[model samples]
Target: MFCYQCEQTDRTNGQPGCASAKGNCGKDATTADLQDLLVHALKGIGQYAALARGLGESDREADRFILFGLFTTLTNVNFDAARFTAFLREAATTRNRVKARCDELAQARGTTIQPLSDAAAWQPGASLPELLAQASTVGIQEGLKKLGEDVIGLRALVLYGLKGVAAYAHHARVLGYESEEVYAGVETTLDFLARHPTDVNALLSHALELGQLNLKVMELLDAANTGRFGIPQPTSVRMTPVAGKAILVSGHDLGDLHALLEATKGTGVQVYTHGEMLPAHGYPTLKAYEHLAGNYGGAWQEQHSDFAKFPGPILMTSNCIIEPLPLYRQRIFTTGPVGWPGVRHLADHDFTTLIQAAKALPGFRETASDESITVGFGHDAVLGVAGKVVDAVKAGKIRHFFLIGGCDGAAPGRNYYTEFAQQAPDDTVVMTLGCNKYRFNRHQFGDIEGIPRLLDLGQCNDSYSAIRIATALATAFGCGVNDLPLSLVISWFEQKAAAVLLTLLALGIRNIRLGPTLPAFLTPNALDILVKQFGIQPLGDARTDLAMALAPRAA
Candidate 1:
């Protein structure tokens, strides 16, 4: 498949990508090629749409499609080759329709314009076989030898960051938030890429610009989440399953989870959050559901064992879906942009069939022992106690703040995050977010003064919360964010985490630690640029890194 998009990419000495028949993420070559064609189709649209905008014509429909289409191609989001083919054909139609409109406007103005560009002029094949042939010229590795691996890597970085932006924007749109700026940003970057500039500096700038756009989208999503459901507050969630009919919902979409909660209310189908949805309990509106039981599993990587062990049906609401075992494959369902070849998908926010299936299956037969973990320490919650936090730091009760968080996975190197959290000095506060926290979120780190040493700050997308807290702490301490006694030890596994890393680098945040192993897509040259520009470093010994972070700032 030749895919190096996620953290689990093959890292052999000669080839640092999955170039075999199947990708490390289980994506087959046919599906990977189709996805490449879909993106190429999107770039074609951008090529024409950018020209169309110059003629005082714009396409809002094309803009929205660009976001939604790229979102479907993100890692572990969609694996159906049929869907990729449909999107490719649909993108061609969307581009041509927009071009036709622009032409009409030009004709009405009594103006003759130059002929359509090569990208806009090209047409897709009429049938599946023809489309398959067309995909060969536009694959991700189309010009790797000519352009050099560094340029290809930089392009992939910008494109993948854009994918992350689309995923977050899609979530916000589902909750009734939309922005023309985000659309413009996506179109502009795609248009830039279509023109084929190979300047390393220019490509790096594009990456950081995508990072800035990602920040805006993250803010929109944050508003959508906190506004729809009240701001997240500190709450203890039950880790043990409750006795009743149960349905486990995983992924990052709060709106989908909310719909499922509303649909199953009073029907005696007890709903439980899993994976990324574990943070739902902190929201006042979601917590109001009496049947919304505790979380059932650990991170997304453990889904095979976790989902199989659960007695009831399982619903995947977003990214990071593993192939379910035969024991529970039929019982697993998908919604939103997430999909699988055979899994039943729920659309229109309706969960009637799913609820029925839940009732039909054997649920938790008896209550498990009581166990709970604290969550919901979102931006508002942390800032709510900013005064106490500041006072503790000034009094030397809290020596440092460790922002150890990111996407969690099943790799052996992932244990480093757990160890890092466990070994943080007793005087430091170990704050976390995303599924990675599942490693040690249950561990007792004790509190510094009145603040809990382990503070869970929602999901992967909640990096906004961490940013807000860091900025506020910097403001409170009368120093820059880097000058504060805080360190960001990010554990990345996918594109969303990649986008967040770019955001930090774009903001000039320095000395950040990223692990378990760098992205395989990062060529040595591109990696050098990041390490030099941002003072970024790969993870080393936790104890050693901890000492460096604890060292006093230069006067």
Candidate 2:
């Protein structure tokens, strides 16, 4: 197995599923085997949901379990060997219960079928090659139209979207909010993927369903965010690391950032935001912490180099972790679902260890001589200026709105985003979210009537903010959302971006230019359906794309 689709691949042009026989990071054969088993177990859990549906027993716990389990398997989230094994055991138990119930139903109907739960019963000592051979014969990868690949790819994208939903739902759960529909979507999607073969129409329907489900998930998260932290206000966050002690927290979890800020309070330890944490500066409750220092790095993909320059400890509260560089390895810690085998792991919302580590690390040395870039243009802030924005548009002061935001990574062509931002028309306003915003965060695009060229709207999860702003803009203008003079040029690198994209589609927004190469997981047919149905086009050259985006739309 060989995999290297992420930014921190040890080897260039590596595989996505597995990077070498035993992942390049010395994951070893045993770990690889367990990871596969864990995936299969989760698949089993999803299959069980169908049985539950049959018995009319759908509930919150089952829904949460499926979403959380799939999200945990996503890259860079969970790497703790022991914790994963325990999760697999739990999955096995759930699988057994599902099988038992199915068997009882079958017996009552005077029908007999093999129990899906018993992994050993299916095939005794069957070689992997034999299973692969049989599966290959019936698999959806061989055809003139490549229908199998297309269907598989569509399902894969939907599964990835579910993973993103789980991540956000889990975050909301941590913040004391839960959505039953989001969880049900997870179970339903899983059941569909586990049992069905590649079918073009079926996959297309699922993709759209994914879009619909993600919209609800984002709304649930948006409610949780605004309820906990007051609506975001426009504010500038310092780009320089503070002098003396500090802890740089990176991840999409605002709750975790708040908790860490609280834990480090009065400890003389300055708190610095990194990656997704940059948005914390915009939140009323979070920014109130005077000790919260400026942002420490550029983006998630740069952690290998950027983290090395950090003068203090770094706590990763979520995804986008690429194996830490040696210089920062000792000072790096992970909490929540994120983990590195030997790295210090904090469990069960316990950030005390993180606080202690920050104290033990070398004090943060002042790095910034002056202010660099300003962030924090969340939904509320944008809405506050909605009238001015509408007037500017009507008055021909702002020509276009470019939402050049999504995930960022070390992919070669990703520089296209920076070039695009640099080349966007002077009369345009750029809105960004997630680490993708880093590309042009410092790029001077000048200003339009006191508003900066680029507006940062927080993290990947805050894509909801952008959606809200878009909808509000449409409402203010009394026109359909797609009728607004706004365009989205998004770059996706992970599951969270997938969820956000689905939400945009659910809202019936169209003509989105997405790039840095389409996901390797997307099949050709699925791509075609997207183009035909939603007018989703891939980005070309920076100049060409920018020109096309700024040009007048067809009547």
Please write out the lDDT profile of model 2 over residues 409-433, one tens digit for every residue.
7767889988988888889898988
Which regions in candidate 1 have their CA more than 4 angstroms from the true location?
52-57, 109-119
TM-score of each: 0.97, 0.88
Lowest summed lDDT across 10 adjacent residues in model 2 is found at: 117-126
Reference-based lDDT, each prediction: 0.86, 0.73
Model 1, 3-80: lDDT tens digits are: 788988877648688788888888888888788778777877877677678777778788878878888888888888
What TM-score would candidate 2 get against the native?
0.88
In terms of TM-score, the best-performing candidate is 1
List of clashing residue pairs for candidate 1: none
Error of 2 at 67 (Å): 2.6
